[model samples]
Target: MKVKELEEHPTFAAVLPPATSEEYDTTGWRAFKPVVDKEKCTGCLICWVYCPEPAIIRTPDRKIEFDYKHCKGCGICEVECPVKAIKMVKEV
Candidate 1:
């Protein structure tokens, strides 16, 4: 099945649900989890800005927290952190 053919099929399109909902939990898809080191963190908020899922948020105390359940573990946080505070570890 070619990609073009699949898109043209009405049966496939009708069977699939709408893509507007945000309630789905995709936590199971992550192969690794990001762990943030509070001591090393400088409150730069770079991780929060680069996060594709926007799972990282600033707390009332200005500390960064992750919404682990919704986080896809894409490592954008780890890569964007200037202080190297966020580390991606195997989900075991």
Candidate 2:
């Protein structure tokens, strides 16, 4: 059960499947979209920069935008936003 032992096991390596676009497509529907409260926002771009999916965008004036198409709704941006501007709302 040690970390080193697990790393050396072929079974662990065999458990994972090879990457494919189908895998990505199938999971696309599960992604969440973030809702921003512009009234509460201070125009900070913390959410824009911290998003792992690059779902957040920053305008020339530092306004924030989210592209729900590619966003997995991981909530990292919402948790990292200093001004509490981003809220992770479940996608319907």
Candidate 3:
């Protein structure tokens, strides 16, 4: 049978349940939050730009902030920071 014909079969529907919250739940998702020491922050935007998820935001004054909602804690920002201002801490 053609791929499209197979996809329409009732048997396929029986085997495949509707998508549910359990299928996409991220209860186990772990992320690292980066803490910036204001004393060490040089106002460089490197961390903001290097974050793969754009989790870091830089203010007009060059102070950096992190949006943990989308941050995966990849540590790229910590590695990219010129000074040791950014430190990765496990999210609670």
Candidate 4:
């Protein structure tokens, strides 16, 4: 496969040979989870853009959603959110 083409779908693990656990259900080890305050969200997508893992999703209604399955609880989303809509709360 061409390098450019491969880069286009870099996270499509099924088609890629070297897939890691980063793209799987790694939530059990997390100590915290980022909760988005929808009322405060401005939909700027800063959190979505800065996420190292594909855990932050932009919904069709222009809302941000979290997929904890692959989230490592890095808090990058919470930090990047300009409106401070996301808060990292301890997981129970």
Candidate 3 ranges with C-alpha deviation above 4 Å = 1-28
In model 1, where is the ten-residue run with the lowest total lDDT?
Answer: 12-21
- Candidate 1's residue-wise lDDT over 1-92, tens digit each? 99999878676434555654347787998999999999998888878888888788798877899888689989888888999999999998
Q: So what's the TM-score on candidate 2?
A: 0.62
* TM-score list, all predictions: 0.73, 0.62, 0.64, 0.74
Residue-wise lDDT of candidate 3 within 1-92, one digit each (tens)? 89999878676334566645334533235466788898899998988777776667887877988776566777888888999899988777
- Candidate 2 C-alpha lDDT tens digits along 1-92: 89999778676334555644323532365456688887888886777767776667776766877776566778888888888888777766
Q: Candidates' lDDT values, in order?
A: 0.85, 0.71, 0.75, 0.87
Q: Model 4 off-target regions past 4 Å?
A: 1-23
Better of 1 and 3 by lDDT: 1
RMSD of 3: 7.1
Q: What is the lDDT of candidate 1?
A: 0.85
Q: Is candidate 2 or candidate 4 better by lDDT?
A: 4
Lowest lDDT sum, 10 consecutive residues, model 2, at: 18-27
What digit string (tens of lDDT, one per residue) describes model 4 on residues 7-87? Answer: 787584466557666556789868999999999998899888899887888998898999888888999998888889999
Candidate with best lDDT: 4
